[model samples]
Target: MTPTTIRHACIAALACAAMSASAHGLKPMSDDELSEVSGQALLSLTNQTYDGLDFTRITLGADIQLSANLSKVRLGEYSYTARNGTGADIDMGLFRFGRSDGTEAQRTVNITDPYFEFVYKNAADASKREVIGMRLGFGSIAGDLGVQLNAISGSLLINGGAAGNYDSHNDPLGGKRWDGTTCTSTCGLTLSQIGQLTAGDASGASRDFFISVLRQAVNFPGVNAATGAPDKALEGFWMNWRDRLYAPVLNAAPPPNLPKPPG
Candidate 1:
């Protein structure tokens, strides 16, 4: 089954458990009891507000290892741009993580605190309440990301280089070369030339990443795909974050020795 389906199934199971507990006379565990637990919950829900937006966040607490593939993925399709068909910020096919023939560790993506967050504007008014955006992020990730793109409208930087085939002459994949001695302008690298894309830092260290889609287009600074120059591009979808997606610090010190949970 798909990763999304599996995740939703888990959430449904948790909801049913919560309902069953409410239906029965089961009392919630005390903080001390909860503290003694060795494992985290499978799911958690949180609601909050910030910057005039209301956020409903569903977080999956497990540290997961998974392998999956998507036949196609199209995000933020709006106006029809000649260079970007369907006007999508990200339009790709055969998106996959890991390899089928690899070992378990090699074929699996390690993800922590996977979360889905929905942003709403005018949430106080029923008729006016609308979901303005949604995002999927991981507190941290370590994995391989395989994809084939038909078109992309926003910035997707990798290894400190931009992913596109545009040049200052507005040519596709014909911009200043990568040799650094070329046009003395911006360099554009196609997905192929960028090689296998791995989710990590320059040193291959794991890090946080986020993928988001919004109703309103957000202007972001990126290389002009058509002209190979730095410019602002408006897009309603984007992936990868230059900062942390979630925190509490991944390498925080463990608490002092405590009693283990009852067997």
Candidate 2:
């Protein structure tokens, strides 16, 4: 081949290699595949009874469908079988389900290289740090975080201040308020309830701050399961917390004798 042609070929090969190296593990589930998965997950949960509550048939919600996302959205709806302590049937009409496994084949999280702001939220005490660190649990929590973070409709639930849940106000991945979603009457968690999207860069900036930190509380750096393994939180966290809370009476002697048995 000619010199110019050979050089161009080399450049093209290198570019292809780079693109391949930057790929993600997210893949779009086929309709059938999603259906099967959703069904399996739903079935596994059916006929199960909570200690104080009983629910009726579980069925798919209208919004349950595949998205332009790596994860599938499986919304489900159900109501109570009978009145409980509340004295009424407060049907959990619809709730989102986490369906993505972290082993998808394309379009996934670039967790190692995400552009993050060093958001320094105050930790009220050492317990908060322990709690935050422990939350990055393995499949139990971190996998779920990965699934949610990559969801097209990922949410950030505000704990109070009349904010039900910031469901659609965040970016598909970063969970940032992207310029708009007007909340004239109610800034709620559902799409129908949202007022409008961020109008422009300036408006978006303000909204980003508002939603990113509405009723702000303690927040720490979020751990990405894709980057590193999460810690075993139950034992590790509890023991550490106990040490911090309890005083050490070093080299203390045991009781002199076995105390009389309790009556």
Candidate 3:
């Protein structure tokens, strides 16, 4: 059967399976069980595509703790860009499922490189360092940079060498300067940390700032999965920040557009 037909068949099968599971006295599992089941489902879904095609990679049980009330799940795909830069596309799929037990199951398929990989860390001094490193590599947070800063700004600042300023003598990677003063290895400043320094009611504000910056830097449109509608706030923030910070990178000469001569 053609790939499309197979995909349709798989969807139908999954629907039937779901119904059967519900009918069988199979009570809903806990969050952990649900996560495992959903992860397995997603893998099955991926394999079903193109006659059991294997994925380049699969990251199972990735944790995305958005909040006490929300749960997140993710899947990723990896592939080379097309030779001509015209048809090559990578897939990065994300699934956000709500959870009451701090554990939930979700699934995705045909995902390329995801725009973001949200990670949760324990609340400790060591964890703070880990978060700081992530922020530097991934850019800022998504929603709380105010009207002035956005995701792109955060990305450029972080990946584009903004964090370097925090380092001694402006080293992009924090390292001890020649003079011997150690750079701030733990540069992460949480909302509580910020509140201690600043005055306003900035509870969780640091996280918001980080999210806004990351969204801007990543250039993600924040499309609604159900309706595929553009998230206005996210789009505007990305565009505005891109123009200011990432424009130079975007406008820079692309690698010679040499496509492998029609194989």
Residue-pair clashes per candidate, as listed?
5, 10, 19
Question: Candidate 2: where are CA atoms >4 Å away?
Answer: 1-190, 193-196, 202-263
For each candidate, give its TM-score against the true structure.
0.55, 0.17, 0.17
* Greater-TM-score candidate between 1 and 3: 1
Residue 246 lDDT in model 1? 17
Given candidate 1, what's the lDDT at residue 150?
51
Residue pairs that clash (backbone atoms under 3 angstroms), model 2? 25-104, 26-106, 179-198, 179-204, 180-197, 180-198, 181-196, 181-197, 181-198, 182-196
| Per-residue lDDT of candidate 3, residues 1-263 (tens digit) | 99999999999999999999889966767888666763223221111111111112122322232311111211111245422111111111111212122212211111212223232233457434122111111111221110111001122112123222211123232111111122234332111111001101223111111122222212222212322312222211121111111111221221121222454
RMSD of each: 15.7, 26.9, 22.9
Q: Of the candidates shown, which would achieve the greatest TM-score relative to the real structure?
A: 1
Off by over 4 Å in 3: 1-155, 158-235, 239-252
- Encode model 1's per-residue lDDT on 142-238: one tens digit a residue: 7655555455444344443323332323323322111212332353444333324456545543443566676763322221132222222233665
Q: Which candidate comes out best when scored by lDDT?
A: 1
lDDT of each: 0.53, 0.25, 0.23
Error of 1 at 80 (Å): 2.5
88-119: candidate 2 lDDT, tens digit per residue? 11111122222232234111211111122212
